[model samples]
Target: MSELLNTSEVFASDPSGLLRGLHRQPVLAVLRVSERQQAQHQLNLLVEAGLRHVELAVALTPAWVELAIELRQSFPSLRLGAASVRCLKGLAAAQSAGLDYVVSPILEPDLLAKAQQAGITLIPGVYTPSEVARAQALGAPAVKLFPASSLGPSYWNSLAGPLSPLPYCIAAGGLSALDARLWLESGVDAVALGGSLFETSQGPQQPLQLRPGLTALLAWLEQRANGDLLSG
Candidate 1:
């Protein structure tokens, strides 16, 4: 059995084990709302619907740093992270805010190195096989495949091997409930869901609805857990 990393624990020497810990859940909800109240509400909804991992996209709100602090305090059990981190300053702010992880839309070597020095888990964004290799070289146990829909699942399938220390891929952008299964089947480690996973009928400010889309994701997790049932 793999030991769980405490929420407060900094980067361990073996970060791959940390990545594997996150992969156990395989779904990371990306919170991208502007209002602090709305973000809190959406986070509650996602948590209630069985999401244990989430990334708060910083660009979505001017008060993202404060909100990250508040959310971290509000939900002690949830693995909260800050996304859209563009530079060393952003990474430092996230770490200071007590976020459990950090993510970026672009791969920045300085930011990654600094995050490591700060003992924060940073998952940098990468799109191409070369970029993926670069991220792995930097010691990231996982990398976010931004605009994943642009490259599509087939492209991921092609990068199967040779990206050693091969970072686990988190598929983000242009992914819908239906498309998630394809990406997972194509060997992607996990999917980062944004606005599309919620119901739009209630307007953008309301808490997201977790049915249908979340249900599909849950089913996939169940199947993944029960390998015999899926394989047979």
Candidate 2:
């Protein structure tokens, strides 16, 4: 753990390079399924479609952690992480489960410190410049722009300026293909697809598969983003 954290710290101050270097894909999909069967199916679908980066929500239950572990073993090349990590326990669970990183809805100082000490990558959710600054102060490698749909692409575009030493921004929450394209074009390092990708009318409680709509959208967004979405 200490060894991993030591390596993680090297990129703590400049996560943009790390994120871009590690995740060659343009988007990171968020999975919030509750059933193990459904979860595995959805993961397999995404992998088959060429999407590798994913954040499995930890709020579900111990099964979520187990699924993460299982997925990691099955898909060795998958970049798996935990999302909605609100407290120490969630962070600890993610670390124990051996996932790649943790995502929080809000930035917690103690959580950040502990993650740094444990060698886990904590991507805190941030919405404003102040929040972004706060995340940077905590040494976060990346800051997820939560409920990003609420702020719209214009809001994301507005942040491109003034936010010096900008952290790697992840456009998450209610992201559409057009929205994803706009965010990526607006300079966001990466976009996160949540319920919009894997969830269906059955809701999160039921097992779901990757939607054809989302698959098409991802392809379109990847092309539209063009040079904005890096491959190397």
Candidate 3:
């Protein structure tokens, strides 16, 4: 049998191996909600859709701690993480909440070190070579290329040539099903998609309604994973 990973050892060795192992499907569900009900509903939907990884942001009111604990119990196989974490306090809070990983919108050395010491995966945000280098030096498992749409796929392609040794980079911000091919081709390990994956017309007050859009997105991802379509 495969050796079990202790929660604290998730980032101890090859962080990319850990990330690839946790998020093998190449698509991650990023649920940003301000209400308890909404968070639960989205979690259920994503789980049903076969997504094994989800990230909850701390900025969401009502907080995601309770939901994270509940999810850990309900979906033992799912890898839970927290996003929008900007400081050491936020990292501690996320770890206390039973999160398997922590994601920040910006690279913070102190916070990264704290996360490493805590033994949780850290995916820090980076927009330039300096930021990526800093994150790599701090032992980040992956660097989130935020606002990737603004930088375009070429930026990732260019970085890959020089930072080939760096851990996987996840492309977030403005990612959509239509652009998955381009982003994946750009050498990113995976993509984090938000609003584009859900039907927002139902509003936060109501449970998220998965419309045809979500189905289409999933189908596209499935096809890509199956090698039916060019990954790029």
TM-score of each: 0.82, 0.81, 0.81
In lDDT terms, how accurate is model 2? 0.73
* Superposed Cα deviation of residue 106, candidate 3 (Å): 0.5
Estimate, for each residue in 9-126, the C-alpha lDDT of model 2 and write its tens digit: 5566433233644344568888875767777787888888777687888864677677678877887767888889999989877887787578888878898888878867788899
Question: Number of clashes in every candidate structure?
Answer: 0, 1, 1
lDDT of 2 at 213: 54
lDDT of 3 by residue, 115-223 (tens): 7776677788999998988877776767899988899877876876676665677889888766766777667778888777777655646756664444555666676
> lDDT (CA) for every model shown?
0.73, 0.73, 0.71
Better candidate by TM-score, 1 or 2? 1
Write candidate 1's Cα lDDT for 1-232 as tens digits: 1123344332452242446555556777787756677677777877777777888776533366677778888887788888789987777677667775788888898988887877677888998888888887787657889999888886776776554435567889888766787788787878888877677758656545654678667666866768845676
TM-score of 3: 0.81
Worst ten in a row by lDDT for model 3: 1-10
Per-residue lDDT value at 231 in model 2: 48
